[model samples]
Target: MKTHKEYLDLMLDGLENTKDKTPNSFSYDVLSAAGILFVEFARRFEELARKFDVDNLEGFELEKRVFQITGLKRKQATYARGLIKITGTVGTVIDEGKIFQTELGEEFRTLERAVIGDKGEIDVKVEALRIGPFGDVDKNTIKISKDYIKGIESVTNPADFTNGYGQESDDDLRERYYSYLQDPPKAGNPAHYRLWAEEVDGVGYAKVYRTWKGPSTVKVVIIDIERKGASSDLVEKVRKHIMEEAPIHWENLTVVSAKEKPIDVAGKIEVRNGYSKSEVIENIKEKITAYLAEVAFKKSYVSFAKVAHAILESEGLVDFDDLRINGTYDNIDLADEEVAVLGQVKLD
Candidate 1:
């Protein structure tokens, strides 16, 4: 017998294997499983946001919030949008506040639910504002720090990292990140629930790596196919395949949208290298987490340099390779100046 977690992993693995064996592309089941895997990823990410005190950190003093709109976005009039019911929660978050949310939005696509929190046991629940046909979700939660509570001021900017969520040390950031990613928080959404958030307030949505592509060439190929009618879920699978099949130059396949447009691509087809259907998806979980963590890494490094530098200032040294980051942060050792430097240094 398999546990619910095991069940999903098995399904995901099987689908990956199928993609390897099949030369054509992903099947309905594979596509469905991939989609479901992303949903689970979002659920887990939301869980991580809370665990990391993503809404607010004790070291750097950065906080954020997650919101959900229960109602649909319909046109009250030709030029106006009627947001039926508005909902969601704002709390402290540890990862890249603006960027991380955007990536999460792309991955989930179906705003199921979102939560915000700072610290302590209490996390506030905000309804998810979404686009269409969302699943049923019962409740959500959020938590934040006392000083960082002002993050919810106007949304978007939320809690500025400059203020500090109480997380002052790189060690603090690292520990919080590690704890959040490694140990997930408890989730209680119904099985039928699936979600997609309304982005910030209006223009854009929360962000995270939507999918991992092998290289520019492959991505170009994928964009063409996606525009032709292939699903982003399936397209992403194919992108992953290209990575395994073509170990080197997989990066060549990566290509980004010029304007973040859904798709209007046209390109050459026929990938020379791609994984067979027999190959299994290695680190599907890792892939998603890594993407989020890396995104957080970039933002955090930029935002918290002053504090990140302090750790190294004591030691007068810094090294990129030695940095240790858990899901939530690039951890620095408080006692050892060198260790602190490790987290302070940026990796190539």
Candidate 2:
């Protein structure tokens, strides 16, 4: 029979080194930590029940023992229900009407610029602070990347503080996949969605959901995690993970890693490639265009691969806000499947 702490320790200890990889790239990133916790917990439970010859016990007795080992409430499953929510919206630079006067008399103005970023881009930082504000309501837990966001000293909106920052909407990408799943890609189905998932943490968290949004490729992920017990270091770990993975998010987006904070996050890495490396550049651009064309997304990376692909496919001519597509690391290479995926990129 193992103690709850022992189980947690065993689970977290088994995780491989995921340090150098992008956010959640390794199996034990934050999103996947829940699964790791579940397996060890169940094993310890069975062991304890059999050791005490309490297998026959049912109802409250069994329940009590289980809780004794896991510290998880019965409703914990449901409690985790919206553990994360990426909206189809984005945070805008907010002016908090603040000014800092240095001892030398230089006035530095400030605003409520929200910390915004997504997976892999989590470590990206701006000349902005990522700390969120306390919501109007109490008990609201909002997590933000520790970058490019400011004005934590004063705030009125709980969302910027409680809800978190980054592209809004997890289902925005799922909606696109559901579209194709609901309606099979028939002939001339100009825009189609491809998807994949893994059984992590006992739930099918979406690792990759690509779609044809407006004019850029957008990606959302539940970063894999390997967590043990609840420790104050947990927050710092999350912050470090985000900062380390920012560069892989985009080609040219500037991701400056900062101090450890809440959920690690970086800026909407703006990737800009030219016709010189157009082959590789165009590869990224095409997938991004297809993805952006289909989803009503939110972002300002209009200067991203979407517009770039449009220029290449059009013989070096690009139109402002031209219809485009999207892609990711998985299918970036030229492959048989890429035919269907790449075809999505066209003059729109």
Candidate 3:
């Protein structure tokens, strides 16, 4: 906690107090520059201390070395999905890579060219080349981008696009690296399956259930990196990735998304002096969120003890009372294939 100014003052004081020496403004000027330089050096040294771990590493070092060693890298922009309905002649052909645009000018292309069927349904889906949430078109938002199509009926999203995200965060990479260490490399193991499932671009976390249905049946339940339920597209991507990377002989692998079960938290808290109620509440919520994220697939119960610890350890919170999260003194027990998501935070 000592500042460079304090260090400089000590040196200056020692020189001035010596009977044989005189320390004046002239000496102060020279010491001040050195003090500031030392301060910067100390600041950089502190930063260097944090760069050793994957959790605190940043920039090229993290992306190039740390993440690369873990066999993971930052995720880039992803395509969005749109359902299209075509009403044309029975033999009409919709070429692959046909570009379509939303009413708002967001463009997407068909994955494969297809001929019009009796029902006039185009089974293959389209994807937006541009990544992120910008490609997430609302239902009925897309109509026609090019003039190649015959008759346009409707275009919409069957389900919400949850995987369209920006570049991966340091926290995400850190978690993946830790997971890689925890799971390690093993063949035909549940942890291995889970690890492989999470390797897909948008996958957040994956849980492996051995013998989910019967003998030789495995189910990999996955969630997106944003902690939301995975989309069908992402599920297929995981399925394919797992099939190619780690295949189990004589075992049936099923890739599915985790079901989100929201556990709304309502509580009251008391903060220490100089802390506002809103700030303390937000801090508590963040702690709870982090705790939930870490223990998401590992445990089914949301421990009230851990919740209390998060609140008590939160900055500016001295004490708390009537802290009833989900109205229970007991932990919230979740069913299989269910992940807890934060819903409401009510505090007094």
* lDDT tens readout by residue for model 1, 151-223: 3432221221110011113332344334434543223111101111111011111111223342222232211
Q: CA lDDT of each candidate?
A: 0.27, 0.30, 0.74
Candidate 3 per-residue C-alpha lDDT over 41-62 given as tens digits, one digit per residue, 9 for 90 to 100: 8888888787776666676778
TM-score between candidate 1 and the true structure: 0.16
Model 1 RMSD in angstroms? 28.2
- Candidate 2 TM-score, true structure as reference: 0.17
Task: Tell me the spans in candidate 3 whose CA falls farther than 4 Å from its real position.
Answer: 1-46, 88-99, 103-106, 110-125, 137-139, 144-167, 211-217, 262-295, 298-332, 340-348
Task: Please estimate how well model 2 matches the true structure, expressed as its whole-model Cα lDDT.
Answer: 0.30
CA RMSD of each candidate after superposition: 28.2, 26.8, 7.5
Q: Each prediction's TM-score against the native?
A: 0.16, 0.17, 0.62
Question: lDDT of model 1 at residue 106?
Answer: 16
The model with the greater TM-score, 1 or 3, is 3
Query: Residue 32, candidate 2: how far off, in angstroms?
Result: 67
Candidate 1 residue runs with Cα over 4 Å from true position: 1-152, 157-241, 244-248, 258-348
